[model samples]
Target chain A: MKKGIILVLVIVGLLVTTSFASVEKPVMGISLISYYNPFFLALRDGAKEALDEIGGTLLESDSQQDVAKQLAAIESFISRGVDVILLNAVDSEGVIPAVELANEAGIPVVTVDNDASGGDVEALVASDNVLAGKLCGEYLVEKLKNEDGVPAGNVVVLDALPVTGVLNRLQGFYSVIQEYPQIRIVSTQNAQGNRTDGFEVMENILLANSNIDAVFAINDPSALGALEAIDAAGRQDEMFIVSVDGAKEAMEAIKNGTSFEMTAAQLPTLIGKIGVETAMKVLNGEEVDRFIPVDVFSVTPENVDEFLEMATF
Target chain B: MNPFVSFLYKNKVTVAFVIIFIFFAIFIPNFLSLNNLMSVGKQIAVNGIIATGMTFVIITGGIDLSVGSLLAVAGVFCAMLVKSGVNSIVVILLTIGLGILIGLTNGLVITKLKIAPFITTLAMLSILRAFALGMSGGRSVSGLGDTFRFIGRGEIFSIPFPLFIMIVVFIIFGFILAQTKFGTHVYAIGENEDTSNILGLKVDKNKIIVYCISGGLAALASIIQTARLNSGQPLTGEGAELDAIAAVVIGGTDLNGGYGRIIGTVFGVAIMGMLTNGLILLNISFYYQLAVKGLVILFAVGVSRKK
Candidate 1:
């Protein structure tokens, strides 16, 4: 036992000496909603690029869409005394306490791609989600109008209601689609904001609404999932899909002229870049806007080549 | 034989934890700080609680995959109740009762129907997940009041509240496992169920109680999780059972059962928590983090195995 105790003490001493050897740099900690989605991966790549330019350390954690895990990540960041924190909240309201903790630590928090409900955030660098939704809605309406010369069709909405950004997209879609009297929303259901759930939900929706002329999925994964379900049911030619997030898969689908027609692409890479740049600005004692909006554009078959590389996850 | 080698072999789990802790402290920046250590403690509390109950089940040669799904169910139930203006204490009690009832059902179906624990719990996992999703309409139930949040977020004397709860659970369950007739019966059954039954050790009753304890503890974890997030998310505990099982197995619990200790599980939980916290602190990429964790778990288990 004495020998074991002496060995452990020696090891502990060695570790303590090594830990003090790390050099000081502007450390930026980022907590993403999850790494399962390719969008977040691209965002991380962008952030990493920006951080590397300044020779700063970037610490990242995947919260797996659990608010508790996100909170823990934020706490870890605070404990490490990071210069800035980039938060992609799993839940808008649930992340308030974590943000507040960062606030107490005097760490500037910049929300990336998603907004938090409360806390003193330095900025929210995100894409215009509402516009993305509006663009998809408008594209769907235009396609339907071109087909019939009057927007008259049954539309199905594959919704993911938990995310505020997705909800904003839905609101934008509603604002446009509600203007067309002939366009009727036949079915609306939650896809839980994932491909598997989207496919399962879309399969059920397809069975119930056989007359669906178009689908507006909340994001690319859901849109792709719906496309798969449509193909499985041999109804790919019967309806087209429009979604937000210009993911690589969705871009390929649009280019291949599959049922996926258009996607309102959010620049996650740009959002991530701007998030870090804004953090740098805040660290330099410069005033920045509370909301930093990144541009979003529609990706269609005609323009897929122009933006295909940018959508690579 | 060297005395040091013998000591290390006898307390492999604890030694493994110490070695791992020292490694992270050396390599990961700010990993040895008091605040970070506390943060890891708080983070591990939820899994630790579940693993404590899981220890009982695994020792009896059973597994509970449904604990994860059951956590979701209890979380949703607690959130819905809180949303409907139910008292915090009442909601906790009701949710716990729901967990016990589900656990009871799991026990009955396994024992009476003579279904293997794996198959029964696996089915329960799917059914309970569906129930949670159905009840919450596939959306997270949020806006849980502050009073309820205190259960998870509140701290006592600068220590996280969840850590205290986990300690209490470990203590009670540890005593029950180490110093009770039920505990011995649990081992007997795991070693040989027919022998235990023939010896009139009330095998079925003990098995039912073990499952009930597992389910009850899972519900307890759900409350802490719900309170921590300040919401009830249907997807809350996805893949959590695997984490518990990994902890139990890493702590020297045999898969075939009848051989483990609660103290070993404590070290197991600590080791797992340290790995997660340390990896992020070291700035390891998420993809590599998964691989490293698997390797470490395998290494720890292998080291702890008796020759």
Candidate 2:
């Protein structure tokens, strides 16, 4: 009779342990490619905030701008038995091994902004980067018209390279400016979307092209670079500048008159937050849409105050 | 006064630096202005401090390519801890510890693993750069407290804190070089490693120390860089080693190693900083500026090349 009582207690203990384990929140793994650029920083914060609200733990790793490191981060996530994984791939095709490992572990994977193609992630949460580019070009076309005067004169482009940001932004420029044949594109150089490099490259263009009427940069960093080059050349008032990525610094530039024109603002934090939320939904056995493309808006001096107050540098 | 003038005669480049400073003061708008002067002085603190440590390694006839990448890596780890509510000083200490470990690895890999310093450091460079970028998801670590930024942007008695740190670093390292036995060994090794080894110099140990110094200095640089920008850029200090090497070489260090001084590099780096500032003022294009920088380094090295 004593042995029977002991068995009963043991079974009860086992049942309690199993139930408590199930009651614990599911864990998620997230890998970020860098924290140097402000856009990704916002995304990191947004994702962290969302994960906190849902009671899910986030296992964060930084790839530090290396493809191999990104792959390692994913592998580390899988080994720890995370329920789901979020990846911001450094290179589009280099993340397959980690993605495959997660797939084998029966863990769902959601790719964040800047996807790793050919990997079967459950969903991709990213900005409509291409469409955002279109908006930028459209904005530029509208801004460059001088009292119904056609957009004309030599133009310079501070383009991003070998990526969606540059390609889409280029499309945006072409979309609106193609109609204005007189707006000649004098030069397009890859500044890699960096402010410091942007200044240097733009300085070269300014020296070579004396009649530049406008500049189209792929991102805010490049736009700021152009502003520096212009200022350095003592030609700040002669140019109309437009770019993408409405980072907080760009707003300051707009306010201070250091940089002229507009930026297509990508929803960096929103995409990050929604990505975490959607990943949770998937973990709960609910269906999430295959793609979430965040929208962007043109930020100008007219509405700059609101964004300035709301933005984080 | 005669001794001072003769001392100035010995370092013609440093004299030239002073002359240029005076020229800018007279000709350039806001050249001697407190803010502009502070900017250049502040910029030097990170590079100069790190270069001071690097001077030891270069004098010992070895090169360290991993300083830039290591800086980013160490910065990321420390910044991560800070964001998670760790005490800043504790984080800094832990980071210094991590830096020492990296430095030890560099020393071991070159001395024990039989890897050439160039190849070993180059590999570390690539690996560390990737590791830094991946750790932070290509984002920057931001919203660091004021105390941290103070290291980069603060001032002591109207002088930038970065400059203050840099001057202190120079004096400390300079004293070691001019007075310490270890400093003598460093020069002896660089001047003739095989002979020094035969003479019973603990070549392996000194090698390790030199690299350790390099790594620790790199950590210091990243910390200042993070404080200055108020964020740790996983991509911070990219291609920075080139500039450092140029400084050392143009300051009259023999590429064959063991024949340079920290003070010489100080002048070399100052020349670079001055040139950059000057070109910016001169409306030089970025591409042209790059060309000019390259040319100046080439010219300086050419002029200083042992005939």
TM-score of chain A of 1: 0.85
Q: Which number leads on TM-score?
A: 1
Candidate 2, lDDT over the whole model: 0.75
Which tens-of-lDDT digit does each residue in B192-282 have in candidate 1? 9889988999988899999999999999999998887788888778889999999999899888989888998998998888888888887
How high is the lDDT of residue A212 in model 1? Answer: 83
Question: Following a full C-alpha superposition, what root-mean-square deviation does model 2 have from the true structure?
Answer: 22.0
Model 2 chain A worst lDDT run, 10 consecutive residues: A15-24
Docking class of 1: acceptable
Top model by lDDT, which number? 1
For model 1, report DockQ: 0.41
What TM-score goes with each of the models? 0.88, 0.53
Q: What is the C-alpha RMSD of each candidate to the true structure, in Å?
A: 4.4, 22.0
Q: DockQ for every model, please.
A: 0.41, 0.02
| Model 2: residues with Cα > 4 Å off, grouped in runs | A1-313, B1-9
lDDT (Cα, tens digit) per residue for candidate 2, span A1-313: 9999898768656633432222135566677778666677778778888877866666676566754445545544554456788888775644554576578768898988877665478888987767767776676666567766665677787886657657866876687778888778899998878888999999899889888878888888888888888988998877878888888888888877664678777777887898888887887788877887877777888888888776754
Lowest summed lDDT across 10 adjacent residues in model 1 chain A is found at: A16-25
